[model samples]
Target: MLPNTLAQEMPRALQHLLAREEQTDMTTLPRRSFLKLAGAGGLALGLYPSLASAQAPAAAGLKPFEQPTAFVQIAANGDVTVTINRLEFGQGVQTALPMILAEELDADWAKVRSKHGSNNPAYADPLFGMHLTGGSTAIKHSYTQYRELGARARAMLLTAAAARWNVDVKTLRTQAGWVLGSGGRKASYGELAEAAMSQPVPEKVTLKNPKDFRIIGKPTTRLDAKAKSSGRQNFGIDVQLPGQLTAVIARPPVFGAKIASLEDGAARAVPGVKTVLRVPLDRGAEGVAVVAEGYWQAKLGRDALKLQWDTSGVEKVDSEKQLAQYRELAGQAGPRHFDADMAPLANAPHTLEAEFVFPYLAHAPMEPLNCTVQIGDNGAELWVGSQMPGLDGMAAARVLGFKPEQIKVNVQTAGGGFGRRAIATSDYVVEACTIAKATRAAGFNVPVRTLWSREDDIKGGYYRPMHLHRARIGFNAQGQVLAWDHTLVGQSIISGTFFEGMMVKNGIDATAIEGMREPYPLPMRLTVHHPKQNVPVLWWRSVGSTHTAYVMETLIDEIARATKQDPVAYRMKLIGDKHPRHRAALQLAVEKSSYGKKALPQGRAWGVAVHESFSTVVAYVVEASVKEGKPVLHRVTAGVHCNLAVNPRTVEAQIQGAALMGLATCLPGAAITLKDGEVQQSNFGDYAVPRITDMPQITVHVVPSADAPTGMGEPGLPPLAPAFANAIARLTGKTPRELPFKLA
Candidate 1:
């Protein structure tokens, strides 16, 4: 695989692509078929060339994202349908994205609708040239792409109206889906669709200025809100195909363990059971696939099957032992990422040393993994909610022994993915394809939907890597840092994946130490250790910021407290003017939350932390108290600097959800552990997730700007835990050393 930079950089690459399109070539038709299909008087959703980049080669044609025929379809009744390229799990891309296109198109808000796209090359990220929804890049990267598409389409409609009315194109203006011309002559976009679509695709189009934006910055309700709240949304798991069969697997007890023997007589005898076959699983393991007419039937068949696993060669991966090993590794220097002078470490007026432990965490999406595969003699089609549809399609084709183009992936709305559905290895998709193929070989050539129970999902691996952070700092009475040394020990999420080449440098994973000494110019020596582990690991919601931000911000707070300084003012002084976004966000939070001026109710104390991730910055000011030995967060005030919030409602909702997820990390029992090669927690009963009762009243505010928006999803998460921890530290003299806050 070719090396690719991280996802957050995608939008900057788009600027280069647009630079080439600046020289308009209006004579060239994007594709011959697009015109022919338009002449045939039907809606055409044809493919366009990809935007060329270092990692993504172009197809030598008009850019797919610049064409409106593929993304927008105007019905006769003026209903504008926009197809989003990224998966909409819970981020509100379905509505937030359409609001972008519709803004430039000047379409009526009520008439606009949105839908998910497929694995088509045209739907791949304009810059990344890959199907991706992670890293919070959806809105950030595609904002300008969709704007140009809408502008070009609107321009075409104006051109068509000018020709029809026998006037200059410049004389016509568009408003709310209508092309308005002189003498009260006007036509709806739907009325001019066929004629306008046949017009040559423009290589150059003007974008609306931020001052003129009618839809971009407005706080609007999500397009899917009513359906979702009304229980009318059809998620991937709700898919039903004719004669479709459901399949469930009995996985190995340990990672990489194989099936020793399987007794399937009782399973095959179960009602509604069609077949049972032992199949290959991810990570070189083996499991028995039970195929039946329904989910319950398949589950019953899987339960009845008597299976044995080979744990002889697999690693048991005891949690306590792994933590001990990580701690040992932390003391040894392997690779240095940041080198700074440590001469002042031993001579400083004051010094502090702290070690923090974070355990493995499961994604635990609300919808357990499920994929529907229908195989034909020549090709196959898959229906699933995937974060990486192109990669998933390729994995399916590889497993089915077919060409990539022969497989079709119909991306669907997901309940919630967090990060599980975006697996780099395509583990769950590959497993589903393998099971479908095995079922076909057993004389059942039908569509099969593979489902994982809640237990299976919780116990299934690919957890956020367990991590250990050790930091030693030297400072003065003024809270000025003299020297700092930090070490991080964790499994590299990119070590074995294709990203290893680009993200891992000189034995250190960039992701493992991403948020170290950022915003503040601290003289720090940072060392990293990437130890190979048997446990399957992947990126969580905020990636490395999950632990790094907690360590950095809480330590910063500690230093401020030790020196008799205000946490907010100390952070401001350290950040200075180098990071204006961070300063703006922190200031916004302080002002909104009344951080320094207002005194909280007797027990409550103010906590402050600011962090930047995925190019977005979020500062949180929280009020917290210790209630009967546990920390209780009463409220949260967030100040976000994501440039421009295309939809403030979406931005606010994202912060709310991210803050809640961050809070879940502090709740008791919120961990995944291993013992004797088996997962100790199977479901919500043992492994904890935040309940409604644990929710804190959250208020979100954004530092507004006209610049393009940055990522909002992951950035909101990194600062939440640290701010909450700081508040707890104020209430109690001791700072929490680990997550899930083991308060006594």
Candidate 2:
């Protein structure tokens, strides 16, 4: 984390973030309203539901938020339902969180079920106190909370069973959803459901030890696997209600650019078109929403509309021009992150000077962003795949002139989000509410489902900030770093958002300087320049690690090559046991991938990279080769040290998917370039994401640990590109500096 100057000047809640930020712990990501209470520390179990509402019964000996009825429900036929607090965006929380709870509850694996949670304060993250699913905190922060939730429920069930058997509560034990009492008396959890819920919820309960865990750490299939495979799973895009109108907006060409004129006669002429209304869009822009009976009609209506001619007010960002400006900024003296002595670099025996360019990247999730809003007389309900529903609910209230409680947000499953759906602006959700408000005001008493097509999401959404990194390193022939001069230039992803107060300070956004000079200590002087860009930007998957990992790893590999030492050994010696997780991960990957011990197939070479993000360490050793003038990754072996593997299957899938996305950056068409302030690539054909053919065979291995879980959703991503790049460097004598490799 970069040094901050505004620590004492910021709010008390924000001041509390400095200690966590200094440790680079992504798990403690905070929200505005939540930070104040979270700063006070010791959030009770299950969020103290009574504090959220007076409806929570003041039952005998059952404290607030300990209501077993909130999270668990047992049916008459012996089925258990567990409510997940976070949105399931294909990261497998739908199964993983349930597994954690079920493990403690001793529920039958075959009869367990999972359902999505809402914007209910009871479902807020136990640590951060917000309705969040990003930052890979779903399992990391809630692992123990879910366990306690299950244990508490089990305790109540035992108490009820004991009462029926006329035995002491301590004499009763649970086994596979059945409570066993003295004299061989037993009752299924479903059989005692009502009486059990009436019993007092426990204030605290002992959790199962790792040795006693029957379900956690096992490679369990997802609860939604069958539905997803059978195409029966319903995402937000698939939601429908009676008389629901579909709306698609015709946004301005550039960010914050407004419409000067409007001609919607042709749009209204489209069949099934209901109405066309000009509405306020994100970033102070205006858009015309074309409402129709269905998506097809709305698409036609949106495409039919024509009228535009106001561009003189906004900045027209060209990719080349922006790159030139970034390069200029990279060379200037700026705010320092690590200001280490650089005198040794002037006369080092060995040195490496390199520059890397990462283009603006769009989060092209399989299911493009969409939201459904049903506006009633005094209240509105939203059904969307929101990572931050609390913030979105507040934003919707503002758009509809309703109180926060009046707006109820039902979290929905998403096909994929990467990081787009977790925007601070609540851009998509607010836009949908605005559309529904417009429809209701125009005598069209109907709910509205606003869908962004692939084109719309790709061309008009926030992108990962394009970045430029320049590094000059000096080291001995033996590979001991003497000095490293590094500079990063990019637009701050959190600069204009609420996160800026916590994530940025002293004119330097720590997000831009993360993943530098650690794991392997090196004397370094790191500086950053955050230029204000017209394009909207947000965190993409692994965030700063996306580019930072690539730069740090490949450059380290280059040093090993120069020093004529084994890359693995060089890393191990530099590592020197300070970070056991990093060492364990790298060593595991080296052994599993058979680095230096096994022969490669013909032209294939071994590529190695290790990185820690979101407190989880993932090391990748790749088999790579250049084929037909393009880089090809044949196979990848990953070693992960996430502390615990709730579901090894989910861990494996996340790695495979993230590695594929990482490989996408190396493809020829991966860059989201702009010319004259307009996105050049609109759809999948031009904007290259890895297709099925591009997928490499990947195998995942986790370093067995009994420690608390870190984060797995994003750690698998950062190390992939660098491992692939290291192999490419070994294949081609030249190092590739820019993304979407342009070969000469």
Candidate 3:
């Protein structure tokens, strides 16, 4: 039996598709359409021919795939099917994972097809012991397992073919999905697949060395590029179901506030309006949903509904007030210490002090939060673009009052995640399920889809907490950095959240204190954390490094200025001579950008910053000019230490994209506030994102290393902010401490 949620919708979804097919000519249907229709027709056809009998069973007592699985199946034809366990959210895992398997299998690349694996614990990353994809672990975690599985499959096939020819297995070699022996006698994998399945599974398999890698390091185009470019990709917004109703939610203006009461007469009177129900915005829930026939109609109805909210707790909280509190907190001595304090500044010949401020920011991904849910008496199913599929399933179970096994989650490709989709805080999925349950209870088998407008996404849930850092550095007469003391004040990102148990301890959130503690060769260094309350903060892309990098790199520039030393050489000295990766990245960035060569056209100046995150060291040099005081970045040159790059082209794309994103955060972008607790900026027009016109000419150079691949998504974000700020300092001869620097 199918789970109750899918069981309830199965008949309806099939009937809808059948009805549509009848209106069109089946002979003229496209191949993709036929595949979609066949899959939806409940044929139970396995993508893997070997798994034809292993159909996903009814609610049996099987454990989920918690460790990643690699399964290859060869059909009667030459088609080779590879199953990938990770969710593909535009991080290129779909292509990258398959490349590893194909390289080891020696399979014909042209005949290979990919399929998404079932949700089972056996497919989880061995490091995390759960089926989750985040933290830049996708490629590194899957590297060995994929290769081993492919090698094992190839060995089995070669053994089967060799036995038929009565030859030693060592004498047979496989290439292009074929097994070959002496005199060029060969058979395709498809011909030997059945016999291969009968062979004993190998207890040990040998993987190919990097020196023999044929396709692993090559720059192959993304497999989904054509589909995405043609608008054929199926994101959550594109999911449609029979009798599915569209929903829009009415959220509280302030975070953690409640809806006291609502008058829904006007909303109910709107065309296509169905129902307006109150839902909880609790731990695993969002606000009440207004369900209707279409998204626009539901939005109209929600806007027409008059609702009163209880804002007692958050009414007095505003951005300005939060800034004031953070500044005060930064000045006080705190109990939590990340590093030992430097001995008092007695007898120091030179001292430098500065304060830097970072404002609260939102992720604001291109596609807002949304979910399509169908609920029944025994279970619920959700379609969403989620990073953490396991968490989504758990949240669905909690919302529906069912066991985790009763919920099914179908992951979709996201327009942009940037860490937002990984978070369950918004609780949009739970809210959609709740609406579906309520609608079903009313005798209407309504499939509900909830859509959050861009405005709703901006003001909802946690934000990157505003931070303030105050630092005092004492230098000796020889300009050798003697002592450093830094205090960071910000809302703890991990406290009072689901991630608190894993990343926070003793009132200190590691993300909030990221770059404050350093391993550099400083004599006396003290890192202090002063935590703040009343602000809801979550991890944004680079987390605390976003603000921490800005503070640390800018301070280094100040020290270099005070000592009258060249900025690049000064940083090279302070970073010590032993760390080769940092030294290599810094040196490459300087050489590639021609640092200190010809002083960027007249009034323009150049600034440099470097940081290490997710095991990748990146250095950035930015050239900017102050126009009437506002800093205009003209060009950016960056060097990345990705070690051995799986795809240099993709790495370059990520670096360039992250550089532009960080530049936006430094100047033209900010989430604003108002006295009445209303968010002043809503939608793209008000909450400005960097456009093509705003982008600078970016050049990214990848430093090759044979080491494991590091993260490409977030490491590029930390350097751009500080690099721009330092350039501004050089241009105006004044250190700008606050973010979104206003020239006028």
Candidate maximizing lDDT: 1
TM-score of each: 0.93, 0.94, 0.87
**lDDT at position 562, candidate 3:** 79
Rate residue 654 of model 3 by lDDT. 79
Q: Give RMSD to native, each candidate.
A: 6.1, 4.1, 11.3
lDDT (10s digit) by residue, model 1, range 1-744: 111323323222111111112222221223443344333321123322232222222224666655677788889888999999999999999998999999999999999999988887668776555567888889877888889878877887887788888899998899998989888899998898777877776767899889999999999999999999999999999989999999999999899999888899999999999999888899999999999999999999999988887899977899899999998999997899889999999899999999999989999999899999999999899999999887788788789999777788899999898889988679989999999998899898889999999999998999999999999999999999999999999999877775554467789877777778887889999989988889999888988899999999999999999999988889989999888989999999999998878878999999899998888899999999998998999999999999999999999999999999999999899999899878899999999989899999999999989998888778899899999999999989988999989978
Candidate 3 lDDT (Cα, whole model)? 0.71
Find the candidate with the highest TM-score and give its number. 2
> What overall lDDT goes with each candidate model?
0.85, 0.84, 0.71
lDDT of model 3 at residue 315? 43
Rank by lDDT (best first): 1, 2, 3
**Candidate 2 lDDT over residue span 1-744, tens digit each:** 322422321221112233334432223333444454333331212232233322323356542224556788889878999988889999999999999999999999899999987777667775555677877778987887788889988888888888888778888888998988777788999998888877766666898989999999999999999999999999999999999999999998888888899999999999999999999999888899999999999999988898795888889999999999999999999999889999999999998999999999999999999999998888888999998887788788788988677778888999899889888789999899999999889889988999999999999858999999999999998999999999999998877676666668788876666677767788989989999888999888888888999999999999999999888899999999788989999999999988898889999988999998877889999999998888889999999999889999999998888888888988889989999999998999999988899899999999999888877788888899889888988889777888877655
Q: Using alpha carbons, what is the TM-score of model 1?
A: 0.93
Candidate 1: where is the Cα deviation over 4 Å?
Answer: 1-61
Q: For each predicted model, how many residue pairs clash, with residues at least 3 apart or on different chains?
A: 0, 0, 16
70-149 per-residue lDDT for model 3 (tens digits): 36778888788777767776677777777888888888887787766533444555333344566566776567667766
